[model samples]
Target chain A: MMQRPPTIKDLARALNISVSTVSRALRNATDINPETRQAVLKLAKEMEYEPNFIAQSLVKKQTHIIGVVVPSIDSNYFSEALSGMTDCAIEQNYHLMICQSNENEVLENKSIRKLLSCNIDGLLISVSLQTKSDNVIKEAQKKHVPVVMFDRIIPGADCTKVIVNEYEGALKAVEHLIKKGCKRIAHIGGPKDLSVSENRKKGYLDALAKHKIPVREELIAHCKSFEEDAIGAIRKVMNAKPRPDAIFFINDLSAITAIEYIRRKGLRIPEDIKIVGFNNDKVSNVVEPALTTVMQPGYEVGKLALGVLIDEIESKSTERQLFELRTTLVTRKSSR
Target chain B: MMQRPPTIKDLARALNISVSTVSRALRNATDINPETRQAVLKLAKEMEYEPNFIAQSLVKKQTHIIGVVVPSIDSNYFSEALSGMTDCAIEQNYHLMICQSNENEVLENKSIRKLLSCNIDGLLISVSLQTKSDNVIKEAQKKHVPVVMFDRIIPGADCTKVIVNEYEGALKAVEHLIKKGCKRIAHIGGPKDLSVSENRKKGYLDALAKHKIPVREELIAHCKSFEEDAIGAIRKVMNAKPRPDAIFFINDLSAITAIEYIRRKGLRIPEDIKIVGFNNDKVSNVVEPALTTVMQPGYEVGKLALGVLIDEIESKSTERQLFELRTTLVTRKSSR
Candidate 1:
């Protein structure tokens, strides 16, 4: 026979006390006598009592669980963000329910619906690249669930958002390459629909304008945020009439693959063509001729997003805010 | 005003149908008339009815939610394992609530208690490095919740466990280095309390013994699974008398740090010191002179562990089983 854990009522019956007294003493309420509280604590420990969060949630109408939806957890960026979120959630006595969309919009919507059905008090989301509409966000709002968006967010959603300054980060990356005396620089961007991709591309173009460099339409390629697509995009940029002397990739994963491709073609980094990437992932440091990239504060963004979401959920605040964190250029062997 | 999502009762009253009929039609029961089913579906969609999983859990006594606890989500190994686990859980119509212990035993216990209170149907755990007792597992079992341990599992837990053949994987790693003519090989191990650390150490010793190599106490270092400690450990080993000509790191993170340390010392890889690591992390490939390591099938382990766990959960099986998955040696530039 399976043994059920001891409950407050069981403790009260065993100790010849009222259930309310047992609960108050176990909670260490000041109104309870010190002796009673101490006895309750000792008995609870002896009986191995575990707190019933579900019952507490029922009374409070708050589960203390936040649902997080991300494109994927396999990447360093997402994992690091999750780590920071976990740290903050634990500190606030909250737990997280995580779901991965695998970069599919349909999966993202399904994840949102599942989380809502599970009675999550709040949500933290990084929308998939293929997400086209804000209907899901509106649905969540209609249900009175507060949401905090991070990294990649819906363009017009009225919610709290935490993001890195992608435009400035991209501009810094390009300016660094231009300062290295590399002309005819090329750009490899991400899916056009994503705000991150669009902002980074704008930075790339504005940086070229600042340097009075001609915009070579042939030197630009947009990819669908996959390694295979990145490979094809790099090849296309390299095969241009006046092949680019340098390249700025939207992310480190793509930049790392491009580095390998360049190496296969017997091209030396910074000497043949310099490279710069976004999201200074750990791979950037480990790769041969370590990559120079923009460091996105993924961990900080996650922490701040959760903090804001909790504030909104608890306080029922309807004021929407946007937070843009800073990004910095990290120089390494690849761009030297 | 916040609007509550429409429920089955709302649909029944609006459609002038019996509540049971409405429920059956909404579920697409075979006995339900086709016209009624289509009408129910259309009304449910128009009313934006979201099923209440919490209420359903109360009635069914099954949450259809699995709780997962890991040491940390920042590492490639844990994230990949989580990916595979998520794939299986979603296929089984289960959602996962995830928590990271951050290698803290207290956090692991807290997470378990919280999950239990949430009434999760089952649990998947990789015990923290600091966990020394099985009280938490016993606690779950007493509550009639099934648990499946994977990767870094507790010894003698009387539960289902999925693990790689660590001893064999380590033995193979050391043997590969020895076969490459490395007469003096060192080891960087993990926390002493962990079963993984103990098993791998045994493998390293047996491999050296099989090769007729003398055991040198000064050449072995046990680290706390961090890059700084790994750096300190590598320095200690490298500074020893008759310094090691090869190193077998317990994991890839440690090995990657060792590679950087060796380079800083101006020693050439494979020529001066061959390196082999356990767990073929993505960083292993990105590192200069890509590392040769043992590939622990983390994804497969996660998938199989969850599969076994669901079977046990559904069947109420009491049989305890241990699954040992195969690990293969991946030779790369560092050990060539």
Candidate 2:
């Protein structure tokens, strides 16, 4: 291991003081007592603690912090993205202040305000499904805080963004199903407002058209959310005038639900109804016949978002950048 | 919808200024321009903004924030728990500042120090598997920051802890395997130093003793981490003197891995060798033959931990509390 430099954290531990206290002493603030300040100074001198060493601690630069807000951390997608964010932040010696929106727009805006009050250097956010306003982004911009959006984002917002290629992923899935001799393919899509949903649905439509298969409006089912709505969507498609030979779901959980529901109806996978899902989650493979899904690369999306945010923060650039990562199809037993 | 009260965020947006600037103006700080302060004061008066309404905004009080550190959010268990923590914290009008340790002790300590520097009111942490010291908690205490541990914890630490009864979960799993008429049972355990590991191992042993099965030390195999070591542990136990009739795993992921491995070895589950795992994760039911495992209420654990931390923070009692939750076994096809 490399020898670490002396910093405010080490001084706080040695002096039995809070890191903020050590910071106050270093800044020669009015609130600190003379004796405490003297002890901190003496200790810093003895230990060769450098105030100019910016990467050592948050206090070294007053703040080397980035604020992040997400819809939820409990979801595998967001959590994996969060892990990637953490890796990049720690590598660059910046700390993260995270807030979860729980898919509520009000909470998302409230979280942004809280982070702004904390004087965050930059902001990173993944918009919640309920988010309908870009007013919060404008407010952040007016405050001179650079902003970056990831995954579930505002379509018209002027900011750096990192997202997986939803359209391509969906197109590939549809093409693979067609190759597997699926003639009448149906889709289970997400809420219409989300870009991911719209893009994927478009891909599904275009792929069907390319294969000389006419789009049947009844074959397309949209769920309000990723809850029991998935089951409702499945029932709607399975009970269609012409039942689909293949089903493509918006996510792995929904696809897994469909698999079980179809099986309970005494249908064999691939033999009765082939299946494909997006976001190659761990459960995609753990399921009985295993799922053929598109890998969203959540971790890469997060890492790239953080890197872009840091670039935007340091460059002071008004020009926005958009990055789209390609998703690969992972074929499994269900699709075959 | 209930009429929402205007707060400093509204004041900031109305004035087209940063939230920090609005906060400074509200405090009558010397740094803000006089005209801006006057504008803010007028807006607050017109909108009936209440500075004393503790729940309205972060500016109302200096801080209503709790710092949280976890090993990794990408895992379903922690993510579900985080969702619970978020629910409780938001309900109680507190924001969360989150940091991920990524299962590194150095990073865990660094994260705790960063949270302390933010001057958080209290802390809720689930220690990383690598965490071995209580020194950081002491440092947090020195700053009057109350902390509560959840999930993976530092045993014997003088603080509130909310954890599932690991011993009970493990015993239930092992007993279920025995009930399936397994004669020679084997176990794939966790790392040696974790209290969770020791408690679970004890449960496995005691369950066998209660069943009057002779102790076979060779049937036990320990893995260092939750990664590929699980496969090695499976190989170790499966190659024992008399290949065990049943395998009890510490967690569901490992048990699934064993299921696949045993099937590849041409062993039929429940017919040749039964299996039981701990933690009824979502994937448990998705897997082939569905895993028989113990249900760990991660979300409940998180909600309870946050509530307890808030109580400790507000009550300011020196007495620490410990909360142990019970686990229920979910019987599935794998063990039957």
Candidate 3:
């Protein structure tokens, strides 16, 4: 049999005090006298009493539980963001509950409802590619629960959004490739439903337009953001007439796919096909010849998202704040 | 104002039934008549009334929340394991609250205590290298909460343990190098406290003994089970007399570090030096020469751990079961 810790009632009885007084003393409530609070603390310490958090939340009306919803946790970028969030939460004595939707809209909604049922204090989300409904998110706002968006965000949503400057990152990547003497450039776009994909595509097009390099309609291909979809999309781009001298991919996963395809064709990186990718993931550094990509501050985004959400949750105001993070280009052998 | 869903009290008032009956009917309890249950379900569906999980847990004594404590979630192995656990949990309509101790014993104990305060139904833990207290684990057991250990496990504990055959995987990795005509091989060891690391080291020694190759004390180096530590240990082995023909690393992180060191020294892989690693992480494929590794079924360990935990939680009389998963080697360009 396990030895259990003492509860508030047990402490109250041991100290010859009422349960309410014990609770107020534990909470350090202003109504409780300082001498009584000190006495209660000493007894609680001797008893090694750990408050029942669930029972305490019932009266305080706050669980201090934050819900984090993400597309996947396997990627280094997402994991880094989560690490930052957890670090800050630990320092603040808060807890984070993670939910992964696997990029499914239905699953994402289900997770939101579950978080709501748990009475989470706030929510942090990176919208899934398949997410289309704002009903659940709006419902959270109505209940005075703050929502903060990060990475893949929902445009125009009435919530604070933390994001990287995709347009500038793309421009830097394309500029680096052009400086490396690439004339014809191609682009591998991400999933159509995501705002990041559209933003990156716009950045690509603007870079070409700014350089007076005519955009070729046949040079752009919309690939599903993951690994399996990348193979088919890259194959099509490789087979195109006047094959691209350089390519800018929306993400590292698809960028590495293009590199693998180029390698299979006996072509060398930079010498035959220069490439640049967004999200300087671990794969970017591990790949043969390495990869030139844009580095987003995942940890910063995470910390900011939590800080912003916590502020909103406490304020309960409808005002939304949008945070745009700056990104930098990391030059490597792939685009040299 | 936010739209409020009908509560059990509201349903009882409208249907002329007691609040207790309404609550039971909402939960589909057998004690409530089938007609009453159907009526409650019909009304709930029409009115969009979602049951409050906290309120329900208060009465049923089941929170439907599972606590997961891991050393780190950023690694490919742990991430894959978590993915499998999350998939299984979602299928069962259960939610997971994950916490990482980041390899600190104090943090691990704190996380466990916090989870217990939340009244989680069960716990799934992968003990960190710094974890040394069986008392901390026993505390959860005393509360009648089931715990299932995965990957890094403790011995002689009265609980279910799920693990991969680490010794067998290490043996295969060593045998591959021997078959490739490696007469002198080196083994990089992980942290001393972990059971998996000790088992793997033992397997490497056994393989050498069986092959009639005299075990050389100078060929072994121990590192903290992390990439940085492995790099330092590998450097020491490289500087030794009669340099090893091949090095067998404990995991992919260390293997990748060794590869980087070799490249920096301008030595060719498999020609000047041969390398093998365990845990076929995604980095294995991206690295130059494509790392040859033993693949542990991390996802299977996670699924099995959760399944065993749920089984034990549901049945009070069930005996503790140990699950050992099989591992296999994947030959790639590095060892070929």
Candidate 4:
């Protein structure tokens, strides 16, 4: 038979102490004697009595639950980030409440408002590609709820941000293609509004400048972050005036789309047109020739994002900080 | 400047009524007149006074949150299922609290305990591969908390379960391979601990038996629901005296693993050995030559799983339900 979890009253009665003393001890209050606190802790641990979060939240005005707002959770990058965040949140005894905006700004705002209504202590957000304003973050800041941006960081936003070194990661991907003796390299970029999109595109151009290859306007196409759109973007690049010999996609999903599109066009990967994708997702490992791409520290970014938010929530500090996580290039046959 | 949402008092003052009257009208209490309820709803809509969930949950003894416990959320199938769940939950003004068991019963128990402590209104679960007992479900049932199981349903469990027709899906896949003139067929099954795994394996054996093809002992291997294990399982099947002409994997991740291993062994897909996988995840579309897969309706399963739990929770009904969603075959190059 399953037994009921011990309550504060039960603990107090067992230890010959007042209920208030048991509660205070569980909260690690300094008024309670260290010996008494240890005794309460020992008993609570023995009974596996996790404190009632609702009652505790009523008193402390906060819970160790952070709202994670994202665009989509089905993709490898976001899920890896979530895996990292879940890993870190479990370690810190914090709960993560995830919300997806589905690339809708109104839905993003609604998720934020709902999270606020649920009394989340902080937020870790990767803004929707369609979100063009920082009004929501500013509003959240006014309410003293800390916000941390990851992956798709917004500029001039007065909040903590955790992002991969996109400019550097992109440069390395393009440089790898250049070193592979591919001229007429094309680019397939993400939504033009996102900072990662602009930064990655800039890195592509930076690589071209460094290699003395003229930047071709017709060779670049901005596409939605869906596989279907990525295919269209790749087709646009493949059909360009010069028809680029290689392509660097903004993200791995888009890169995979480009690879598939090229294959459908009766071309071969790395032979007819070499390809490099970003965010080395699991599919990157299995994609027919194995996609050579930049591996963003997605899980690490998530961990640090939650870590920083938890620190701010506990300390009630308002200092803005940015943590830039690094990325690495994983070379495979796709870029050979 | 962003203002706080209007409260009941704001509506009471505007309409020249008492706070209790405003609250009753908002809740559609019978004591309130029909005209008053309509007026209150119109004003509440205008004021955007969405009942604060945190405050309301305290009084209603309901969180409007469903606790979803899964074995692994990082996998494509689980993530897709979660995405569908979140989409539906948000539409119904309910929040989702996700917990990953990491395929450990101990971890699954811990997550369940946490969800219960949070006063989750209902549960949507897909049992872990290592879960040997139904104690967790029994405990929740005793406490009057509703649970809905999906994908890997527990056998003989007194609870509402939403699952795909695993037996039929597997039978069709194997029969398709047989029609392709494959006499030597191998089956890479999931963990024996799961009911779905057993059913799929039984279906495979039943298909071969019907085809008058004697099942070979060396041609079957259990992968235990892991990609890495499936690789080894496929190797074992490939190394058998009479190498299997076609292989049917129970899950997509495992199927991809087997395909990669086959390629590594210098064999071509369908040309050297035909392959079939389950769960038509995005990888099924992107994987080279594309995989022939069983398209289990993950979104519909999620919706129905949560739908049943919500129905039971709201009605406080005690009837156990069994819901098995159907699966369809998505033929592609891998099997053809």
Top candidate, metric lDDT: 1
Ranking of all predicted structures according to lDDT, beginning with the best and ending with the worst: 1, 4, 2, 3
Question: Across residues B167-269, which tens digit of lDDT does each residue of candidate 2 receive?
Answer: 9888888888787788899989988868878899999999999999987878899988754458888898889878999988888877876776897789988
What 10-residue stretch in candidate 1 chain B is worst by lDDT?
Answer: B281-290
Candidate DockQ values, in order, are 0.40, 0.27, 0.40, 0.40
lDDT of 3 by residue, B131-240 (tens): 76677778888787888888877777778889888898898889889999998889998888667778899889988988988888778988975555576789988876
C-alpha root-mean-square deviation, candidate 4? 4.1
How displaced is residue A228 in candidate 2, in Å? 6.7
- If you superpose only chain B onto the true chain B, what TM-score does each candidate give? 0.89, 0.82, 0.89, 0.85
In every candidate, how many clashes are there?
A: 0, 0, 0, 0
lDDT of each: 0.86, 0.83, 0.82, 0.83
- Model 4, position A136: C-alpha lDDT score: 86
C-alpha lDDT of residue B200 in model 4: 90
Q: For candidate 3, list the clashing residue pairs, or say none.
A: none
* Fnat measured on candidate 1: 0.58
